[model samples]
Target: MKLLRISDLRAADIEAIWSLVGGGDASLRGTIAWSFEGNGIRTRTTFIQAFRDLGLAFTELPNLLKTDERACDLAGYLDPFYDAYVVREANHARLAEFAAASRRPVVNAMSSQGHPCEVLTDAFYLHTRVAPLERARVCLWGPTTNVLRSWHELAGVLGFPLRHACDRRFHETLDKVTFTEAAILPADVVITDGWPQGADDPRWSLTEEHLARMGSPMLLPTPPFSIGRELAFDPLRYRGFAGYAQKQLLLPVHKAILRHVLSR
Candidate 1:
């Protein structure tokens, strides 16, 4: 069982993952190889704590596994000893190749094309904290990046209303979902990915005013989000800014993911 993308997950798998988070999770314990980058401080810390709590050993691979041949060779070498593999890569195709080559369950920590784990964490948090996901109106304000793609896939699977607000220049890349400019939209949960370089529209920056106009929807910005880029005000002072505590849930969510995959 591998989860390389959000669309790869089924409804049953999604429920099972949530169940694991609720406790009484079985052993997902074993040696796990992590091929991740240096900038993944949040991910690394969460994974380390989750692994320790779940009785799994963590090993960081030195190589990025840039090419298929290298990824294949590494997978084969680790297949005998490792219980699972976690890969964080920018290239989706490369991560696919690696997952294809691995005999053990492979988990996508993240890729440029999608981020299943992070998005799942968000959905779970919303459901547990704000309201049922079905009742919430999600508004994603950013370019067509990994986070957006994952949210799109999950929203499709879950049958929720998701709106993408961005610069009109990038709308052509999106499909099927509701699209809008950087104007105020009726949103229960407002999210943002990274800022596009030189897309210096003040409207694109999610200001306190925008949140106020939207009736004080929760503001959950994706990690690596800059203060001045995607945000116009200090999010901490904002009423709906629950990101700091919300992000901490990544540990349990990821632990649930590991258990769900390995249990299969």
Candidate 2:
């Protein structure tokens, strides 16, 4: 999982992503994934340089969820995109085709269905630092992307109950998943992140009031927003705090999770 193009991230955020990758295993030392804009030679050249330096595969994909066919077509190029691709908010049929077509594994990437890797890591992190996954009440606040998909996947796999709070527009109908518009409620695990959008301004945050509403001990992967201040310091408020499963470093996390699942 070298590269991704979720609208939730920006070019500047690439540094933090690099940090995670750089600190990962030597097997992934050179793997790279990045967002692309097909402007002209300069943009392509820059992207090439970045990949060359990082020793990663390259790809260009539309960041928005507009047409299914276009998304499928774009995802079909996973070989050129990345050694392992993560197609966020894409169609599962397209993902299946990409996986079938590519000799290399194209992870569920991401769709409305589930983000297996994200959930795996989130559950692993929670299990490691806080408590058993099955013994927790996880609360998710945000839209239906890899995050919510992850929650559903984690809950199903670990036999945990998950409650979701998202704006109506981003909410989807699912049998196992329950949705609500009210503010986030506390649970054993509380994960909150933003909707993928054009602008990634740090000011868009879940307020202190929102945080106060949670009833139980918690885990926050990344906070609800990307403010300049570090969210890790607020440990006093929440019993056990963890950064949101860093999706930026999805490659290593994805690979680890894939190995875990496929190995089984």
Candidate 3:
């Protein structure tokens, strides 16, 4: 009956989960289905392959663009058949309601409030590549979107130093989180989500100049990045940059979720 939020997990819990993922192949019982509003091609493909590798039946519920009520109804209908429900939607409140009503464990694929799976994968990647979660100086450069919110949640749970550099308009929306307009220097990891629509501010964009100011840090850009907006050049050229597509992270994340579900 536990809601899977990053804030609810302890540092030991995260390490244990990642350890399980690293060990390879966790026990997953019954079927899994993904019901999403957005086109999660990468997510769906990665998860389907993961499930196939694990010998589990996986289904992608045909983009059921339902209203909040209909989505909850669908969740109720699928509760008996599926062991786990992975949902991505714009409505965070409705998703919470659906999770509460579901008999199975609910995974927040993505929501307006947070993107826990992405953050979890990012954390694991950082722990392995950059530094331990406790020691890593993380800097998030973008609006106070769901991705940033999840990072904030992770920072709260793991007690990591997470700095933010965004416009003042978006800064006020972040609760109890302080950010600066000045450049984010001396960072161990520099991450960014997509640029806000209609903002059109070059300062907010993660260009070559900003990357230079950040020194030699692990550059991790969230997927679906634009050339002119998110980055000035192709990230693939940079040795430190994690690739544009994060489909590979999905396997570890799914394994971690399965481990958590089995443990419960």
Best by lDDT: 1
In terms of lDDT, model 3 sits at 0.72
1-264 per-residue lDDT for model 3 (tens digits): 333467667777777777777556644567877677777676666666667766667677755435445656877788888877666777777777777767787777777788787788888888877688778878888777778888888887777667888887777534435588875678887888876567667767677667777786778888777777767778887776876544487787767666676466
For 190-227, candidate 1 gives per-residue lDDT tens digits of 89877655666666778887888888998888877788
- Candidate 1, residue 106: lDDT: 88
Report lDDT per candidate.
0.81, 0.48, 0.72
What is the TM-score of candidate 2?
0.52
**Of 1 and 2, which scores higher on TM-score?**
1
Off by over 4 Å in 2: 1-93, 102-104, 108-114, 168-176, 183-185, 198-205, 219-224, 227-255, 258-264
Tell me the spans in candidate 3 whose CA falls farther than 4 Å from its real position: 1-4, 63-75, 172-177, 244-247
Query: Which TM-score value belongs to model 1?
Result: 0.92
Error of 3 at 219 (Å): 1.0
- Model 2: clashing residue pairs? 2-33, 3-33, 186-214, 186-215, 221-243, 221-244, 222-244
Question: Cα deviation in Å at residue 195, candidate 3?
Answer: 2.1
lDDT of 3 at 217: 75
> Candidate 3 — worst ten consecutive residues by lDDT sum?
62-71
